[model samples]
Target chain A: MQKEVMFAGFGGQGILLSAKLLAHAAMNQGAEVMWIPSYGPEMRGGTAYCTVIVSDRLIGSPIVKNPTHLVAMNRPSLEKFAPVVKSDGVVMINSSLIPVRSGRDDVDELIVPANDAAIEVGSVRCANIIAVAAFAARSKMVDLEILRECVKSQFASKAKLIPLNMAAFDKGLELAEGK
Target chain B: MAKVLMKGNEAIGEAAIRAGCLNYFAYPITPQSEVAEYLAKRLPEAGGTFVQGESEVAVGYMIFGAAACGERVMTTSSSPGVSLMSEAISYIAGARCPAVFVNIMRGGPGLGGILPSQGDYFQATKGGGHGDYHMLVMAPDGVQEAVEMTMQAFPLAEKYRGPVMIMGDGMIGQMMEPVEFPEDLYVPPTNKDEWATNGMDTRKSDTKNIVKSLYLDPTVLNDHNLLLKSQYDRMKEEEVRFENYNTDGDYQALIVSYGTMSRVCKTAIDEMKAQGLEIGMVRPKTLFPFPEKAIHDAASKPGCKVVVSIEMSMGQMVEDVERVVKGKTPVQWYGQCGGEVPTPQKVMEHIQSLLNS
Candidate 1:
């Protein structure tokens, strides 16, 4: 089985980082994975998106048009992607930014105040970590431990941000559970 | 042999270093410029030679000079830059010097675009340098393969006495993926006194070796072409690599693609399969010795009706696919050139239309 997820938002919102972290977590679980980021002109202040494919078998393509999961970090991203989510697929929206809900009833919609949750934890930059933690908890796509490992690896060089990021991740898990 | 996350270009440089290649000569080009930049720092640390030649033209000849000295040497460029290197590439092929060249292709008819493009298919497989010479072209779609193929390319070049190219696009070059370096370093055979014109002191007779592609006699040139053909024939027998996906079932259509385009085709196939359409893919890993036999076999399968060639170029490899299918399967072409990649939806629509027709 294969699952494709797209994380899209404005630049510096950590959309690309979140997608990569999920892909890395899937890879650590011994799954075949691919992460493709938007390149060229589309990357500068435009909608920066990344596509991640995680599969039990070898992944065929890294380009995903209809993703099983769509994580929209902004209103523009949610407006652009809500229509493309597959039936019964999950669409996670950052409630703090996006006001409207997904139009499709066939899919599962989760509105998490990712930015607010991150702010509550410490900083707004941790919003991506929060979204990733929520996605991991709800989708069960990858183990929470693996997500933690991915987070650690991503920030391994930074070293000092580990504790705060872990706290932010925990807060995200609680928020996901509350939903 | 632990996996480390590395950009594709960086991995290729590391692999080249581990292959015991001492001399690296290259100019900077986007998507693949990282390879030169990485080697600039890494090669010196490893006590190897690294020079950023003034231009791709100079870099190619610099490689020629090092290869002539019987040292394992390499150079890298993208499409437009590679066009400049073609002059030297042809010279190197004609002189029968072994060197590894990496082309991390960007879109181009002429400085086309910088995204990623497989449009150099014809240039890489059939148009290396010029005149009846074929370089072994290896198309690596991912970072791990990029690393492994680069390490393998040097020895393969020496084994065949010609240039070997690791052809990839910007996506493969710039993207970061996990790759493990090979456990053992490959030490190529020393041929300095034998073939290279290093010096004449050690030989029994003090004679100068001339390294030139200019064979004045027509018959000698014909003989040289024939020898190259024989070597190509041997390579055809030895080096066809491909990946087959979901080909067992009765399929309405088959997708033929390679490199980054193949990855896109895979996603399209999966989505089509979910919609109850049976489709398969034949992804060629080696472009030159064009997996003709595999194409033939795939076409011959029962219930395989239409074969579509998806590429980043305008119908270059499609001709080869048509040649191999032999009029049995209806062959078609779908492509986007100048670095514009065809999305999975576009590919699916093309397949759906073909299947419906």
Candidate 2:
């Protein structure tokens, strides 16, 4: 089985990092994974996105026209990528920034106030962590433990931020579970 | 070593290091700047030399200079940057200095967009610079292959004593994949003392070692050209590398593709297989040798009617494909050059139409 997830937002929204973390997690689980960033001439406020493809077998194509999941960190990303997601796939909406729904009744729509939750937990910088955690929890594409370990190691370079990110992770999971 | 997730550009830099190449000179250009960015930090850590040249032209000569001294040297650039380096590449090729060049190709005729493209196919396999010299070129489909090719390129370059290029698109440079570098792939630079300009005292030779491309004398220049042609002929005979997918039984169509574009075609072939349609593919790993025998043999299959060249450029490699097939089967070309990769669905549709025709 193959699953492709697209993480998209403005350039400074940590979109590429979130995708990389998920891809790393999937790779650690022995799945073939490819993380492709849209390395166009993106400025600070311009659109930036990346796709992470995980497969049981060798991944033939790194490019995915229709992803199995979309982690839209902003309204434009949601509006742009929502229509292209395959039916019955998971679409995560960052409710703090994006106010509209995916408007698709066939797929599972995940609504999480990632930015607000990150702010509540500690800093808004951890919003991507929150979004990915909630998405991983809702989608179950990867083990939550593996995803959590990936998150920790991602911030291993900055040890002080681990606790805040862990709190954000918990909050995201809690929010996704509707608690 | 354990597997690690790495961007193709970064992995390429590391691979060069693993191959014991100690010198790197390059100018940064997107979609491939990461190689220079990576080696700038890592090369120093490995007790190597890293120089960010003032320009790609200078970078090319930097490579030429180090290589002339028999040092394992390399440089990475994109399309326009590589264009600027072509002069030096020609000089290095004429002088028979072993060097590695990584072109993480971007779009264009001029200063086009910084996106993945196979637009440099003609320039790479055909001669980018003047004269009748071909850089031994390899096109890698993915990051793992990129690493292996980058590591192996050093030895291949030394073996040929000519420039060896790793031709990848911007996608290969930017994409991240898990890679475990093969152990024992590093072959130390060999046979350089005989001709390398490493000083007479160093080699303990009576004659001075001079590296030059100047052969103004007609008879002498013709002999040199013939010698180069003979080496290229040897390469064509010995170094042809390609992969055949699903070509075992009777297949209706044959695909000729390379680099990242081949991967998309593979996906299309796989999806079509489930629908009871069979298509086979020949992915050329070495673009220089052109995989002539492989293409000819694949196209010669009794069931194969039409051969298609799917590339990211506007029918560049298709020329080589058509030449190799030599009218045995009808050759078709489908591609895009504006940096938008042709999708697998589109490829499938094209092949389906071709079969119907």
Candidate 3:
């Protein structure tokens, strides 16, 4: 089986980083993974997106017309990508920024207040971590423990941000599990 | 070694290092600039020299100079940058120096766009530079293959005593995938004392080695061209590499594609197989010294009705496919250019319509 997860948001929201973290986690777990970024003429608030494809078998195509999941960190991202997500796939909406729903009944929609969660955890930058954690928890695509370790190492160079990001991760898991 | 997830551009840089190529010169371009960025930091750690030239034109000559001295050398660039470097490539080919040139292709003609494109098919296979010279071109479908091809290109260049090119699309440069560098593939630089100006005293000989591409005498230039032709002929006999998919079955149509375009074709083939349509594909790993016999035999298969050359360009490789097939079967071209990769669904639809008609 193959699952493609698209992360879309503003440039500084760490969309590419979170997607890369997820791909790294999947690779560490012995799964074939590909992380494809939308590159070219990108600005801070303009728009940015990336796609992570995880698979059991060798992956063939990096381009996906419809991904299995969507993590929309902003209203534009939600509006742009939510329509193409497959039925029964998870569509996680950052309710903190997006006000509308996906309006699809067949798929799993998880409302994640990622920005608020990141603010509560002491840094708004960790909102991407929150959304990624919540999506991973709900989708169960990768081992949560492995994902946590990957996140830890991603911030290992930074050192001090580890605790804050870990708190954000746990809160995301808690919120996702509660749902 | 442990598997690491890395972007294709950075992996190629590390692969060159693994192959013991210490000298690198390049100018930054989108989708492929990461290679220069990567080597700038890593080459020093490996006791190698990394220089970013003032422009791509200068970078080309830098590679030529290093290779003429028998140093393992390389440069990475996009389509337009490669255009500026073509003159040097021809000079290097004429001088018989070994070098590696990697083109992480983007949209073309001019500065089209910074997205994945295979529009350089003709340019790579049919001599981007002047004269009857061709760089041994290899197109990789994914990051792992890109790493392997980059590592292998050094030895291949040395073996043929000419330039080798690793032709990849922007997606191959930007995408990150898991890759492992096998220790067995590393080859130490070959002995170039015979032709390289590594110095007469260093070789303990009174004779000096001179490297030049200018042949003023007509007969001597003809002989030089013939010598280069012989090497290319040998490559056609030995260096042609390709991969077959679903060809064992009596497929109705044959697809010829390369690089990232072939991967999408594979997906389309898989989907078609599920729907009981037995389509096959011949993916050329080496664009130059292309698999002529393989394509001919696949096209001549009794059940094959049509052969399609699917590419990112409108119809470049199709001309080669037509030449190879020789009218045994109808050949068609299908593609999208300017950074828009054709989807598997669209490919399947087009093939299904072709078969029906």
Candidate 4:
């Protein structure tokens, strides 16, 4: 099995974290994975992003040109990356922030209000976690339980923060499942 | 082996410590700065020393000083920084002070951008310094391989009693992957009393181990160069490392590459395989004592037609490939410079045109 996922958003939105969570879960499940960020001066600000590739076999190139799953957490990310997703791939656009739809008819597009969902649950910083849950549920690329545990481990050093992140993850999962 | 995820740069740093290296001196450079950053904390914890040199030039001498004392010393830098370290590298070579250095390469004719490129192939395998020298060069593709090579570099340097380099591009230094470092590869080096310049106290007898490269005598300098050449010849015989993929089949095309470019070529080969095109790849793990015979053998496969050298440079390694192919099969070159890695699609298009023409 092989899947390429790209998580794109503003620098502070934890795009790198959500992608790291998926990459960690894939490794925990015994798959070869690589996580490459949009490194260079472009990373100083503006649209920050990272790509995670998980495969049962050796991954040839980590710098992917077209990802199978695209998680656009903002309007700029959607506008830039939506058309590049594979024809049969899955895309999750943050409906609360990005109002534009990925006009591709061949792919599955899930409009997730991750920002509103995170705020409804607890913290605004949990928006990336919500997108992670939505992508996990929609693509079925990784086990949902594994993804949740990966998310919780991100806050492992801060014991008091786990419960809030879990609540945010559940709210996002619920939204994706209902759609 | 417990697998943990880590960036390539950080993993290389951790692997050096695990390999029993104790001294590190480096200056910060993009893409490879994480190596120094990671080593700063871990080296202290492991009872090792980590120094951020005032400049790349200073770090080069710092490693030479530590290595002169028989420590498994190391330094890391990108292309531009490596240029600054070249003079010291030549001294370390001439003096035969064993040290490990990593060059996570970036594009460069001069201060080219900080993105992944393999333009340093010639500078690395051929000599970046102003002397006749050969650094045991290991080019790794993934984080796991990078760790293995970093671990092996120390022993290789000590064995040959010269400089060793782990050559990789910015991608290999920046990308993250799951890596399990080998527990048994951590080898403590042998006693350096035979050649290393410890203090007058360390030498039991009156014989002083003066580590200096200045052989003003013409006969003495020639003898020293001949000694270095002899070790390189042995490394070429015993230390050559490479791997082949799908080469057993009746292949019509063979591609020679190393590090990240080889990985992309594998992707292109896989795509071509699905369409019933047979293309094999030879990834040279060691770029210096570069698996020449292996290239000749792979290119001489029953159905092999053309041999192509794919790289991120403006076609540097192609010269070495041609030297090995020796008019057996037509040697071709494909490359892109200035930090731009040739994508799989682009490589495939280029290879297809080569085949069709």
Candidate 3 stretches with Cα past 4 Å from truth are A41-45, B204-206
Candidate 4 C-alpha lDDT tens digits along A52-162:
999999999766889998999999999889888998998998999987899999999988999988888888898988889888888888898988888887898997989
By summed lDDT, which 10 consecutive residues of candidate 2 chain B come out lowest? Answer: B199-208
Q: Mind giving the per-residue lDDT tens digits that candidate 3 earns over B1-357?
A: 789999999999999999999999999999799999999999999999999999999999999999988899999999999999999999999999999999999997799988999988888889889998988999999999999999999999999989999999999999999999987888876568778887666775567788899999999999999999999999999999999999997999999999999989999999999999999999999999999999999999999999999999979999999999999999999999988899999999999999999
TM-score of each: 0.87, 0.98, 0.98, 0.97
lDDT of each: 0.86, 0.93, 0.93, 0.90
- Residue A110 Cα positional deviation in candidate 3, in Å, after optimal superposition: 0.8
Total clashes for model 2 = 0
Candidate 2 Cα errors over 4 Å, as ranges: A42-45, B204-206
- Candidate 2 structure quality by residue, lDDT tens digits, A1-179: 99999999998789999999899889889999999998877533499999999999999988799999999999999999999999999999999999899999988999999999999998999999999999999999888899899999988999999999999889988988988
**Any residue pairs clashing in model 1, and if so which?**
A61-B263
| Alpha-carbon shift of residue B319 in model 3 (angstroms) | 1.0
After superposition, the stretches of candidate 4 with alpha carbons farther than 4 Å from their true spots are: B200-206
DockQ of each: 0.43, 0.85, 0.86, 0.78
Clashes of each: 1, 0, 0, 0
Estimate, for each residue in B1-357, the C-alpha lDDT of model 1 and write its tens digit.
Answer: 656767788899999999988899999988788899899999999999998899998999999999987788999899999999999999999998999999998888898888888888888888757799999999997988888888888888887888999999988987767678875546566554556777776654466777789998999999999988998999999988888887978788888998889988887888889999989888898898889989888987889889999998888889999999999899999999766788888999999988787
Which clashing pairs does model 2 show?
Answer: none
Which wins on TM-score, candidate 1 or candidate 2?
2
Q: What is the lDDT, from 0 to 100, of the residue B23 in candidate 3?
A: 98
Real contacts recovered, all predictions: 0.45, 0.77, 0.81, 0.64
